[model samples]
Target: MESKDLVSDDGRITYRSGVAARLAGLSPETLRVWERRYNLSNVERSARGQRLYSAEQVRRLSLLKQLVDQGHAIGVLAPMSVDRLQELAGAAAGRPKAAGPLKVGVVGANLARRIAASNRDGSDLVVQHSWSHLDQVALTSPLADVEVLVIELSELHDSALPLILSAARACDGAAVVVLYRFCASATIRALRAHACLAARVPADVGELLSLCRSALAGDRLPPAPPLPTSDLRFDEDALFNIMASGSGLACECPKHLADLLLMVGSFERYSAQCASRNEDDAQLHNELGRAAGQARVILEAAMERLARADGLPLPPGLIK
Candidate 1:
């Protein structure tokens, strides 16, 4: 196999087995063996059963050879899906586009600026304007064009949720991530019942940025409804009626409490798995206990800070 054997055709290419072997920096026999053993090559065959190589295939083979030269195991890469292989190659070539943070028309300037500032290094779109500006953005922007919406409903005259819902209707598939300061569970539940998407963002810019990033990345758990409206105290009858209605008690107030419930649900899953598995029962129990305890500590610390920032006393019953 030699370099001179390589021939090009109008940006297309045809490879003699020997030439492909040379381009791949492998012996012709080794090339055939790779084709048979790993199915790694994307070579096509002419009607005469002669193998033909496209330029793309040649480039891929060259990349594969480079990876092998770098001590990567060919066997490990042999079964990679084409998409995964391309992603790896793109990453190696630094081709992945790093679009700045997805934009949002944040309703509250102070909170919006703080959240945007926190996510300076990550991707985000920050809108600093009045609620009316938010409405205009949502109504006129291309549908589902934005990934998340951060609105401060507490300061608004009209119900923010309706605007959000209208935006959600316009956007259709886009996620409407609402930001709330202090809202009752009933309000949150009402929003969720209408199938609006929302998440609880801490007052801290850092935490809010993290929340927004996770939401935009589709990596966070599906959020619960907004926090319970603070001013409204529901009577038992009212609570019971809400509970017996559609969505059941699980969707009831303190909308973001769903995050807690979901976290516990995960713990329950691991607990069940440990109980079902026969090996290392004691070790598993200890490991789970430690993880849960650590999580509890972190949650408590954050809750204390959040309580202070919001100027709200932590409900005694809410502390776990």
Candidate 2:
């Protein structure tokens, strides 16, 4: 069903599967599985046979996801009513219905202001610290006592990875939410691998708040898949030869090729450090592997192009 179907003249609001998934912090596939296996919610079918969910159902699903993240078994929570589920969650947390506000540390002033404004009507969230840059969070660990850390960035750059990692460490077990104006797929994947939640900018404040709640409740998604490395074996002599040939190429090819090579080399060094530190499971390591894999592809293509330009014989393995 299209998103337009979310509103009706009867004053009831419904959401399609995609919208529901976003609200509930679940994938559409996971929602379908829940519907088929656990009968978690009463989903309706659109005229085109697409799934539709009511507002209450979405809330239940969000609560379920949060509970599951808190280590509650889905089989137990799925069969219970929303009130019962809330009671159980509150009991598990050893808190009253109206618990104290969550302490939050925000990295950007604008984000801090927006969060403050959003909570003007009252919410169980408090902004304890605000910094104009991530560097401050990394250095001062101002968020060390907060329950959650929210960082706002214009873009996700390689240089920012260390700062993010350091902030995560300082915050102890606090959940992290990274809101970016623009981010690459690799960067998103990397952040997820490190247990950091990422969201795009221009998002609804409600959704962001929901994300924060879920994160604080321990509802983190699985790590991204490891980078493909089956064909990434690096041959020292072949790479040296390619660089030598690329250096003599006309135009920008030489510079681009050199940059790619340097990037790959840097990634390799970073990966080695991660392994030495026993941080092979860390997000930065996986990101470095993915970056190195990408660089290898470009470097190989450049080598092939240089070989064609020089009329040199191509290596059998590099034919593709």
> Using Cα atoms with residue i matched to residue i, what is each candidate's TM-score against the true structure?
0.32, 0.40
207-271: candidate 1 lDDT, tens digit per residue? 55555554444321122222222322232222222222334234333323324432433353344
Span of ten consecutive residues with least summed lDDT in model 2: 217-226
* Model 1 poorest 10 in a row by lDDT: 220-229
Candidate 2 clash pair list: none
User: Which candidate gets the maximum TM-score versus the true structure?
Assistant: 2
RMSD vs true structure, all candidates: 16.9, 14.6
TM-score of 1: 0.32
| Residue 215 local lDDT, model 2 | 61
Report lDDT (CA) for all predictions: 0.51, 0.68
